[model samples]
Target: MPGERKAETMEEVDLLVCGAGAGGMTAALVAALEGLNVVLAEKTAQVGGTTSTSGGTTWVPGTHLSEQAGVPDKVEDARAFLESVVANRGGARLREAFLASGRAAIEELDRKTDVKFVAAAAHPDYLDGPGAAYGGRALGPVMFDGKLLGREDFDRVRPPRREFMGLGGMMVGRNELGALLSPFASLANLRSTLGIVGGYVLDRVSYKRGTRLLMGNALVARLLYSLRKAKVPVLFESGVRELMIEDGRVVGAVLEGPTGTRRIRARKGVVLATGGICWNRKIRERLFPAGTRDYALGPQTNTGDGADVAMAVGARFDDGGDSPALWMPCSSYTRPDGSLAVWPHIILDRAKPGLFAVDAKGKRFVNEANSYHDFAMGQIATGAIPAHLVCDAAFMRRYGMGMILPGAGNLAAMLKAGYVIEAKTLAELAGRLGCDAKVLAETVEAYNRSASTGVDEAFGRGSSVVNRFNGDAEAGGSNPCLGPVGAGPYYAMAVRPADLASSAGLAGDEFGRVLNEEGEPIAGLYACGNDLASIFRGTYPGPGTTIGPAMVFGWRVAKHAAGKLTDQPETVSGVMTDERTKNATL
Candidate 1:
């Protein structure tokens, strides 16, 4: 036993962060900035985790960026908004900690790290409630030049999902999407599209993927760049197998990687941010609702390693939330390479004009324009296990559905692949979907009546701000989310419930320290990102909710470890006053 232990290489650092996501990278970067020797371990060869593939919206309300964008917000307002919406599903203290530190976290990152964020001009809150802002609350990462990271580091950054990209590996943003989707719409659009495509073409000459990175790719690249700048050692393809305990305190961890097993001692603390339990089938079965499928949008490597090691100790899971996971309706099809590609139906076609979803019996179920989470919830509540998103041929050509691109000429290929069903008549479409022709025809007739009047009497399709914001205002007559599905042939794409990430995870204190079953902090054990229980308690309040809290708490964890934060209340670098520090322990 002694010889085996001796054979393992031992290393020491002030802080050891397990995970290479936004939260974990933030921890390592901050700790290193605070003059602490830090090491970051990523289970996979690539960094970024799911963040690289995400929209990279960080919802941190009441920041300087908001004021700069002329959409000023207040922390108190955000608190009131959360209190009204979130209620008592999660700890009030944790929410307060996030609220108090969010501005400071973003400000600190902007001032010290390569990470930069620009507030969205018009991104609305997913839910309408007291103290919610129209915009400025959500910030998107500034574009990053992937070439600046060099070929080796650039290659280390995880690529965005194939479904979200263009060409082979070009990352596209929402701003350029309109131009690229309709390049000849205007002179400006044509120029913009050309510039974007030209940039990608130039990028391909020297890079494996697009050099001009946006959204999650930009966020991950900035964090990765900052970590490298701070000289933090990143252990790629290394995972924490067990947390080494010394007198009831987490002192180190035994990690397994490509080379061999190694032990790293953390003098201050260790932070867990290894995505979550979304891919852990055993835990997924236990926590998720019955009949939920085994599919997650996150990388498959997120198999609960962080929770497993923490739970192996005295740490307990936080199972108190509206749901165990964040939901997204996904559809899958095999790619030309013979690999399966799962496409998340998130805020693209569902809320657009000329589309509607129906249950197995051909009855309209939910407000198709509702948020993805609420849409999935509607499916579960109404027994619409495999809901069908129906649209006319005109809609398919204009908006597309699931993985089908707008105005795409590959309809025949998709139909042949069974990703989409096409038919010349509503009755024929119903036959393919296994629904009664009479019921299907009647449902369409009723929906058409509502579309003509621009009033969805059944589901209130475009009544909300978010609904209209995501809808095609130029296309729909009165209600942007309402349009006639009359033009034939008809098409259908079935979507099933899939989680973008896990909300239920290890319980932790406001300081991001992992809590034991007795409701006390486990010494030197901290968590952030999906590894920690969601502060909002499974509520999808707004854009970037997950990433916002993740970075804030990660900042808290690092500051606490570096001895810069304490139990005594104090001002935090001019970002928070004494009043704001009441709930947070400095």
Candidate 2:
């Protein structure tokens, strides 16, 4: 074959990316700070995929961190709060390219690198609808010192989430879960729970894991230490088994990993950023919502492998939204080593002040401080699909259920491992959830007459601002989310709905490229976190609504793959071995 040279099984690069979360490491750290020639791959073996078990927040509205916290925001009031809660599902030019690249990709990744962030000046927006704000567009990540990712690259950063970590391996954050869950409330929450259990007993005698990296595992260990100080390689377990189309464009990717099958290429594109399609069960039974069930504990290597390798190369599938996933409500059990956990009710005991969720005729349904993506669609529009939540035993000995901890764990081995259930009455917790004990004591005497008049009047649980940002601001004159499941030995748990994020993806354009079904643009394809689509289609806006359009369309797919290079290098210098990137020295 004439001196057999077709670029020897190819492994080049001008940008390749594909799922290393936080929008594939902020589109391979802004296409390797413009110098390009990036790589990134990652299908697990750790590179912080589900954005390292989240809460790293990113929302981003009008910025300058809300004009230095006096709260600013306006891109026409974030386009009138995404046209009053994203009804157009990712259009209007991808929601005005996520309001002009969400504060210019967090002020150019904080002027280029240790990837800092701050703006949660009271995090709100999860819906006050039209131009909502309360807290200038979320923002979070300021705590990454995993010894600056060295100690063998900080043990490959991906901590936080052995069921949201704590004591048995540390890493707590969110203001140290309020002084380690209200340590006897004061004395400054007992010296912040003895300085967070003496810094996890001195971070377990010099680390093996907790080197103190906060949420979304300190934004994926500060974007994997800014892609290893802008050297940018990332590989991990690899993946993307297809997408090399030639004359049609997308020039590279056939990965697989551990050295089997290679073919990388990528002259100036290929971004994708998987982390979506919520554990795809044939795209969650063809776009969720009908007894939905991809069982979402997030990151089971988000099958939908970059939307089935970009819709098997002819991309297309935005399957619209409004709930193609992104709800919560999880609960599973098993842990005394047999592993199984799950948990995820998100927001500490559903905005405190006791709790509720019922049904099976025992009544009560949602608004237990809403937003767990609308309380799992208000338990499937109040049929309360497999519900229960309840709670008591003095709010389970000061907040803790679902992963059952407080007094630091074990409520009689989580009620003999049934995951939770205690009941000293409510007619023995409605005779152990078979419901009817006079309709669970008339739904706990009409929810203790709407918690002694803090007035839920059926479903108002601490009326909004994200339920006073997850309630209990010193629960004083009651309704800090209406507490009053008063002291019974009660408990409960047993719930359903899951999928933390998927909301139908693929379909792109205002620069992150990808798009088909005749709408055009697939050339050298691209996509950003959760592989595009969701421009609020499934609407869960704020508190980092899906990492602020996955860091603003992964910095608009690295400035549209650096403007399809006509011989780039007029200055993309973050130094990926300069010399004007002589074909990235392949």
Best by TM-score: 1
Q: Write the per-residue lDDT of candidate 1 for residues 398-431, one digit (tens) a residue.
A: 8788888889577888898989988999989999
Q: Give the TM-score of candidate 2.
A: 0.35
Task: Superpose all Cα atoms of candidate 1 onto the true structure and report the RMSD in Å to 1 decimal.
Answer: 3.1
What is the Cα-based lDDT of residue 177 in candidate 2?
Answer: 75
Which regions in candidate 1 have their CA more than 4 angstroms from the true location?
1-9, 568-586
Q: Which stretch of 10 consecutive residues in model 2 shows the poorest summed lDDT? A: 571-580
With a 3 Å backbone cut-off (N, CA, C), the pairs that clash in candidate 2 are 59-544
lDDT of 2 by residue, 42-105 (tens): 8777787677787878887887878887877777777787787876454665666567557767
Angstrom error of the Cα, residue 412, model 2: value is 21
Top candidate, metric lDDT: 1
Compute each candidate's TM-score over C-alphas.
Answer: 0.95, 0.35
